[model samples]
Target: MKNLGARTGFLITLGLVSLCLAPCQAQTQGSGTKSTTASAIFPNGEKGSAQTFTGTVWVQNLVATDSIYQLASGSVTFEPGARSFWHSHPSGQILLVTDGVGYHQLKGEPRQTIRKGDVVKCPPKIPHWHGASADSPMTHIHIVPNTEKGIVNWLQAVTDAEYHGAR
Candidate 1:
C-alpha cells in the first residue's frame, strides 16, 4: 500500500491540475443539458466509431504516442450503457477512473465495478472491455505504455449477455 495513495490521490490531484491547465470544452446532451465528461480537462475530442464502440463514446487525445516516449494518453467518456469492443494492448494499459460508475472485465474474469478514484491496471495482451453502467455515465483516463510494439488490438464487441451478466 505504499504507493496506493500515490496512484489514487496524487493521480487525482495531477489530473485536476492538468485539467485546469489543459484546454477544455463544454459538453451538451441531446436534451441540451450540460453533462459531465470523461476527461474534464480536455475537450470532447472525437466520437468513437461505431465499429469500436457500442453506444455514444467520446475520446480526447492527450499525449500522442511518439517514438521517444512510446506512450499514449487519452480520456474516454461513455454514455450510460456505452462500452468498447474487446481489445488488448501489446504492452499494457492503466485506467484511472475519474468519474461515475462503470464496469471493467478481462476475458474470462468476473466484471469489476469501478468508480471515482479507482485505478485499473490491464495486463499485456489481455482481452478486456469497459464502459458505463446501465444507468450511469462514466469516464476514465487511459495510459498506454510501450507503444513501439503497437498500442491496441481491437477485437469483437461485448455482447449484451457478456456485459450485463453476473460479475
Candidate 2:
C-alpha cells in the first residue's frame, strides 16, 4: 500500500511539472523563427475607383500572390451609401466584417444585413454585391483565393432601385 501511494504521488508530481513546462517550451521553441516586426503594418490604402464602386470606398491591399493557388486579401472601408459594382470572383471570395452595418446580396436574392463578426462566403462565379448601408459606414476584410485566372469580373452598378428594395 505504501509503494502504491508513492507511485501515485510520483505520477502527480510529474504531471504538474509537465504542465508547468509546456507553456514555457512553447514560448521558447518559436524564438528561432522569423519574428514579426512593425513592417507588417500597412499604411493608408487607395481610394476605390468609380469604375469599380458606386460611391466612396477605401481599400488597403494586404496580400497579393502570383504563385500557384494565387490569393489576394485586403481591407475595404465603405462610406455610407457606398458599394461595389456587381461582381464575381473566378475562384471564390470571403468577407469578414470588422465594423458597422452592411448589406450583401446575391443575384436574384434579397439583400441581407451583415454586421461585425459576420462572415460571408461567395462561391466561385456567383454574382454578388456588398456595401455599406445608406446610414452607416462599414469595414470588412476581403479574401480571394485561387486567383490564377485573375480575380474579379465587374458587371453593372447596383441601382438605387435595387438597393432600396431590400426586404
Candidate 3:
C-alpha cells in the first residue's frame, strides 16, 4: 500500500510538471500564426528588446467594443527625444503612464512632467502631444474609442522649436 501511494504521488508530480510546461510551450510557439525571428531573438522581457522606431509606433487594434460600450486601449513607447505629431480626439483620450519619465502638454499650456503611475486626461478636441524626454525612454497606455467620426485626428509632427520652448 505504501509503494502504491508513492507511485501515485510521483505520477501526480509528473503530471503537474507537464501542465506547467505546456503553457510555456504554447506561448513560445505563438497563437499558431507566423512568428518572426525577432520574437525568438528577444523574449517578452529584455532590456532594449522592444522595437524602436524614429517616429511614433502604436500597438494596433488592441481594444474592442462590448454589448454595452466600446473599449479602446493601446500601448505607445517613445524613444528618447521622440514625440507624436499634433493630434486631437473627437471624444477625448486618457493616458496611463507605465514606465520611465516623460512630458505631456495640452494646447496653450506649459509642458508637465509625467512619471510612472500618472493618469492624464486630454480633453476633447484639444491638440497635444506626449513623449519621452530628451534623455529617457517612456511608455504609456493610450485609451480612446471608436466613435461616429473616429476618435483621433492626427496632424503634423511637433517641431523642435515648439517642443523645447519653456514649459
Candidate 4:
C-alpha cells in the first residue's frame, strides 16, 4: 500500500511539471499577432550548436527569422585554403575577424590579408568574398541584413585562380 501511494504521488508531480512547462513552450511557438514589441515579445533564445562541415569550416547561425531585418548573423570558420563563393548582399555586410589570418576583397580591387581584431564592412551592392588564407584558418562573424526581397545574392563560386591570384 505504501508503494502504491508513492507511485501515485510521483505521477501527480510529473503531471504538474508538464502542465507548468506547456504554456511556456506554447508561447515560444505561438505568440504571433501580439501587440507586444518584438524584443519584449521574443527574447533571444540561445544560439544553436556549431555545425562543422567536412571541410575545416564551421558555422553557427545566431539569428534568422521571418520578421527581423537586423538580419541573419553567423560565425564562419574557414580552413586554410578554403573560401566562400563570390557573393554580395542586398544591403551590405559586416565582418569581424576573431582569429587567424584570411583574405577579403571587393571586386576590381586587390585582395587584402585580414588579421585578428580587424573589422570589415562591405558596402551595399558591392561584390566581395572573404575566406581563410592559403596557410591559415580564419574565423569571422558575418552579419547580413535580412530583407523582404532577399538577403544574399550569390554569384559564381570563388575560383581557385581568383582566390590565389594577387595580394
Could you tell me which residue pairs clash in candidate 3? none
What is candidate 3's lDDT per residue for 12-110, written digit by digit as tens?
999999999988887766745432222232222322212323243444345554544564666676667777777898888999887667888898898
- The candidate maximizing TM-score is 1
Which pairs clash (backbone N, Cα, C closer than 3 Å) in model 4?
none
User: Please, what is the TM-score per model?
Assistant: 0.77, 0.72, 0.62, 0.63
TM-score: model 1 vs. ground truth: 0.77
State the TM-score for model 2. Answer: 0.72
Q: How many clashes would you count in candidate 1?
A: 0
TM-score of 3: 0.62
lDDT of 2 at 19: 100
Residue 1's lDDT within candidate 2 is 100
Best by lDDT: 1
Each candidate: what lDDT?
0.89, 0.84, 0.70, 0.72
Clashes of each: 0, 0, 0, 0
lDDT of 2 by residue, 1-167 (tens): 99999999999999999999987887677545432111113443899999999898888998877696489999888888899999999987999988778899988889999998899999899999999988877788899998887799999999997787643
- Candidate 1 segments whose C-alpha is farther than 4 A from its true place: 1-34, 37-39
List the candidate numbers ranked by lDDT, top first. Answer: 1, 2, 4, 3
In model 2, the worst 10-residue window by lDDT is 35-44
Winner of 3 and 4 under TM-score: 4
